[model samples]
Target chain A: MSNTISALPGATYEGAVRVQEMGLCGMISLRGDHGDEKLISAIKDIMGTVMPGQREIVHQDERAAAWMSPDELLLLLPYADVRDALTRLETALAGTHFLAVNVSDARAVFRLHGGSAREVIAKLCPVDMSPGAFGPGQIRRTRMAQIPAAFWMPDEDSVHVVCFRSVAQYAFDLLKQSAHPQAGVGLYA
Target chain B: MMILTCPCCGVTGEETEFHQGGEAHLTRFGPGSSETEFHDYLFSKENPKGVHLERWRHAYGCGKWFIAARNTVTLEVYGTYAAQTTEPPQDIKDTLSAKVPGWSWREFA
Candidate 1:
């Protein structure tokens, strides 16, 4: 059997902020009516977290559920547990109008660490990156430079970003360039 | 830089985050309709200089379609609402009425 590999596996860059590729994250794209009792309970049972509100992300340990849209969610868990989770979701949602598919390999995740982490992201995205505006638990699906990406802060000093696997290199380079040690804009500082 | 708010997720963002879908509240004139009606439905569009209603997609955000009542000339946005609506809501109409008196478009006034 072939071992799974992450896009830009083991890549790391240290600039104003530290950027590292988060390898092999299991992600499930679940689409359905958010108001449906069956859908909500199934997600709660599988992810051990309640459905997140709009633009919100709920995380417990390695499990998380992020609201992608009114009828869509992005569930994160251990890569190896994706198969079992999908099966459980399917069985729980049988005959229900929903879509639960493993998207672990289709996307890439990067972690940015350091006090200037928000500034690095702010340079690329149009979102308000100030501490008062964008803090922990808030997830934003927006354009990073030119690619479709989503990011959320785990705390004041760390951010987790997800983008398409095809653009992993571009995303990494963008982060690295924006985080250049001497390029600090001091806007978020 | 035009700013827009996605009614689906309530995220206010720049125009780059949303995709303009041209005219809004378009009524389809499908088969059995006259050629003129079909042509108007497909090709003809209201290019009003003021108080224009349009469709916008939150392409980089929630990926939901919404409606916007904007002024092309003044770049004033009256309001945004869910795309499931058939026409601009009453509050939007009231706002537009207060701003541009005697303004009417298509079947709305």
Candidate 2:
């Protein structure tokens, strides 16, 4: 069996926004035609959830799927179940113009909590984080400082960020700096 | 920074959320086309100083590509539309005409 390690090495911060690395989750990049009934049905059968619409996320317990684009969805689940899920999905989507890639190691994910989580993200990304604009349960593919990243909010006080594994440390540092009380960055409304 | 609204996601955000894809509505010249045609298709671009239509992607938002009409000098975004279109819609043309009389773009111009 192969071993896995956290990108941030057990790093955790307690500040205005609590930042912690969400280590070693199974991530799959799924691309298919959402308008195709066969593909949709197969994905539903394998994932137990239909593909999410633009900026939408469908979550069930430890499994979640977020729409990456019009024709792409990112599936997140327990690391142990990845092999089983891939097999089932491959069997269901046979002979179709679809792509399922195991990208768990390609990216690192982090969860930010506390009341100022949104503001801290706002400092790094240009997308509107206000409740009126980007509310709870919405996912967006954007940039963190200069790094490509994606993030979503499960509730009013929390956000989950995923960035390329190579820049995991830089992303974490940027988040940590933004969470500082004296950072004093202006948030766009 | 300028704000652009994505037609796909209905999310209006800063320029950072969108990537500029340069001139839109180009007639792609592939193999069998003349040298001039290929040259025009590959290099010659209309860098108009006035109203221009462009291709943009909401890379950070919906991740869908789109098109936008804007002014180069004024930085005024006339509007944004779907990327699948072959040319600017009538409404976009009307808006551009209203903003600048006798405004024409490429074949439409």
Which prediction has the highest lDDT against the true structure? 1
| TM-score for all models, in order of appearance | 0.98, 0.92
Query: Is model 1 an incorrect, acceptable, medium or high docking prediction?
Result: high
DockQ of each: 0.90, 0.62
Q: Candidate 2, B46: how far from true, in Å?
A: 0.6
Give candidate 1's error at residue A136 in angstroms. Answer: 0.8
- Candidates in order have lDDT scores of 0.94, 0.85
**Native A-B contacts reproduced, model 1:** 0.86
Per-candidate TM-score, first chain only?
0.98, 0.94
Worst 10 residues of 2 chain B by lDDT: B57-66
What are the per-residue Cα lDDT tens digits for candidate 2 across A1-189?
Answer: 667886876777877779999888899998988787877886677667777887788887788888887788899889878888888888888888899898988889999998888899988888668778886767888878998899988888889999999999999999899988776454532
Model 2 chain A weakest 10-residue run by lDDT: A180-189
DockQ for candidate 1, C-alpha atoms: 0.90
lDDT tens per residue, model 1, A1-189: 898899998999999999999999999999999999998899889999988999999998899999999999999999999999999999999998999999999999999999999999999999999998998998999999899999999989999999999999999999999999999989876
Model 2 complex DockQ against the native: 0.62
